[model samples]
Target: MRFPWGPGDVADLPTVGAGVDTLSDLSRSAEPPGVRLRTARAQARAFRAEFALTGTPDTVVTCDLVTLPYPTRFGLFRASRAIAPFLSITNRMLVIRWRDSDGRPRVLLFEPSDVELGRYTPYFDNLARKTPGVLERRMVREHGTVLGHLARLGIRPDDVDYLMFDHLHTQDLRRWLGTTAHQDDLDARPRAAFPRAKVVVQRDELAGMAELHPLQRPWYQPDTYRDVPPEAFLPIDGSIVLGPGVAVVKTPGHVFGNQSLVVNTSTGIWVSSENVIAAEALTPEHSRLPGIAKWARGWQQEVVLNANTIETTADQYNSAVLEKTLADRSQADPRFLQFFPSSELTGAWTNPGTTPTFSHGHITHGVQPV
Candidate 1:
């Protein structure tokens, strides 16, 4: 719970206010707002960890570094704002260039988006959820610090071995898997932004994040796995297959191990997840996607568990009706199929290209680094 942001935790604000010039950082206070997960024997033991979509995916490459512009809350997702009051979600910090069934070179990063992992108004300030500065000036005019957004795709952070996440809400992972208590004090701790990465989660989400159920620990940062050990954690109790098209689709009820990643691109089979918000909310036909599906009426489509962490509405509606095949029918630009969402993408930010749903390119000026 102690995570405000640095290499994974480094704060130094206080420059002044209309953007305040700077400082005034104050962070991590929302440790309560749960929706489900108390017992049905822990929802039938997280509904026996299921995963679908097999074979036909031995090719890929993709990068959509950043596209954030958020607002229109149903607490932040469930198709937020329904039809507008401002909404633009696209925090796509991705990078995948696959091959590994012995084919090697599997450099990956499922959810790389983190501009100093923006505090997002102390996580909805316990739901008063309003905006005067507009998500802190679009997160300081739009993010940077994900190790310099992976050095603008030229890649680094130990050339990234594998770092996945479809859950671990305001994530931190000790900066990137480098805290075996104190790796012989490498300059004062918190290091490993990638260092040959190996962080594949979902052993029932590290046992439901070691029992953090006080209403899902305010979207959790769980001190970024605090002392991070136990062989640095590779734990997978459901969907496996890390290469030859890359797979990680546990698809649990959004939190007790919510996984989704099935890259096999050229515009096909690209399923990544923040738990089905758009892609038409994985079609049961008509959820054109918008928030407060509270419990979705009439023909029941609101599997809206926007990280509602443990609701288990029929296991998040069978993981949003099997996340419409994570990606296998192809189409990344217009028809909106490659289902990607680690954050910032609820409805083309403001009806830009207008279709079923759309987001494109992803890169915006200045470019800072440290």
Candidate 2:
């Protein structure tokens, strides 16, 4: 099948051109004057329209999963820090393909990361200093880089159409978004992995990173995207449909501007987020939350905060509940609520095969591949 992105190899994928160029220029700022208020309102309304539609995808969308190995602290995934102290998690990125609103083949990549890159590996850098030999040990057992993992699944650096991170924690977007206006290739700096892809990020999320709060600054690696040109991003406020069955919704809790992607797969509506590590942990009740989430009740705790708890404790609780409501509840026997963890953290303890392996479907044709 041909794609409107262009014919032949993905290198031919067109840039976000003149027709859609206004997208990059659109401001999602929420200041005193709010110059872009009308545009922001239009986005909000578009999201509401899609939210109300509530139906299966217009086309059978498919998502190909690849988990790039990364070390994770056990204290983060669960509320209990006493049990397992650390875990082996992968930075899971999904390449979702479907027909867009324009009836053309489209692709969306979620949580793109190459931890081996100097900018993206600051977390490991800290670990090396604090624990010593920790990163080296993990690297020895690690699988491969993000690009390498994608290649194993038949995707290359140029294959991606859109790059979206759940939240930029320890990410170096320049590695994927490509560096802009840099003339010297000999500068020893990395370029964008997906030159044809436009980055999808929340307005506030990008703004917050420009000058991060000391609390959440540890996980952030701003050097990655600090120099990125404004035109490379497609910033949005609230939720809006990206294509037929895919939408990025605002589900802030893990971070102030955190978001989640909702996809209508063959199984059901699958949501990818960093709000909660595992779907099982989000034990739902009759219109209420259970387990550790209930403990956060009075404080409005819904699910255990993943890592960057920030000042959104109550917000995280509410967002967790909201995420649960969006999950597919078609199963009863250890319910397979189509909720996916953006990080490989869950695979470490819950299911190992999913660590650097696939959880479902195929890259070419997902669940109902023909």
Candidate 3:
């Protein structure tokens, strides 16, 4: 149907190959957001130099970096008005692309700006007010450019086959679930926007959310409304196989049903959504520990399932055990020193000493980076 951004001509973009890696590296560096501006400039210089040396002036390649500000409430102890009129949060999105194995084109979308801004609205808002830096502005500018580039790539609103939502923020969930009674209704037509795709989710995790909190009951409708039984939603014990090319892993502790997708691109690329914020407590790498410990602490009781009891019912008891283990590990691990150094359980923004950062598609076992 001739999408907006030349869909079939991915090779024309010179920076496509290194786009994802560059974004990841930029995000992971220890430099303060202010200093990162210079780092970004240096990166652009290097890319230009490499391209020039290669004599690829006619490459016609472009890279779009974006930082989107998600309007949200602020304050840890004090809650903001239900609907604040002003924008008050910050987050980012990184998109990259390549041709798939079947020679069909593909794009990679990562690090949702909305989700991050929702989760840490207060912190980001404070940072923005106190020190407005180049890094922050650059992130916002890049995010806008990326969106424009996507439009150019022919990625029409309709061509998006998969929405692949990692985890819904409370506000986002309310907005989404409030729109329709049946989850399937939301999956169809103009509302669905993205079509011909299964909205994959972790079966056990979905069930757990309904059991844990009364407020989350509405959000659990996606798995419950299906004609099939609970087991039908659960394709695997640890991971839910959605289809031949996609799978959902149980990345608990971010939200009860927070799951991540393992997507096999047509071009031989295996990408994990890595629901970093939603599943922050499941990450094995110590370096990735979030500064705020409370975020992990809040979801710990709701998400973790015991490894020993995983085989028993694969439901209730296992969840209890997982939560206990996370609480224990967070206390004993030195890596969580910044967040939970003294084994003190603090607010939702404070870390409480846990190993394995949880997020969508991030499980402690059987996760091999691609």
Predicted candidate 2 versus true structure: per-residue lDDT over 162-280, tens digit per residue: 88888877776665665555524227455766777888776677667666677776787765554555566776665667766677777665777788877765556677787766554
The sequence of per-residue lDDT tens digits that candidate 1 reaches over residues 177-201 is 6675663423556766677777676
Rank list by TM-score: 2, 3, 1
All models: lDDT? 0.50, 0.54, 0.30
Residues 261-313 of candidate 3: C-alpha lDDT, one tens digit per residue: 33333222122332221222232232233333443354432222212112222
Residue 99 CA error for candidate 1 (Å)?
A: 14
- Residue 34, candidate 2: how far off, in angstroms? 28
Count backbone overlaps in model 1: 20
- Scanning candidate 1 in windows of ten residues, the lowest lDDT window is 16-25
What TM-score would candidate 2 get against the native?
0.69
Could you list the CA RMSD of all candidates, in the order they appear?
20.3, 9.3, 17.9
Instruction: Pick out the ten consecutive residues of candidate 3 with the lowest summed lDDT.
Output: 337-346
Per-candidate count of clashing residue pairs (backbone under 3 Å): 20, 4, 48
For each candidate in turn, the TM-score is: 0.30, 0.69, 0.33
Candidate 1 lDDT score at position 176: 72
Judging by TM-score, tell me the better candidate of 1 and 3: 3
Query: Which regions of candidate 3 fall more than 4 Å away from where they truly are?
Result: 1-142, 145-149, 170-192, 195-198, 203-246, 263-370
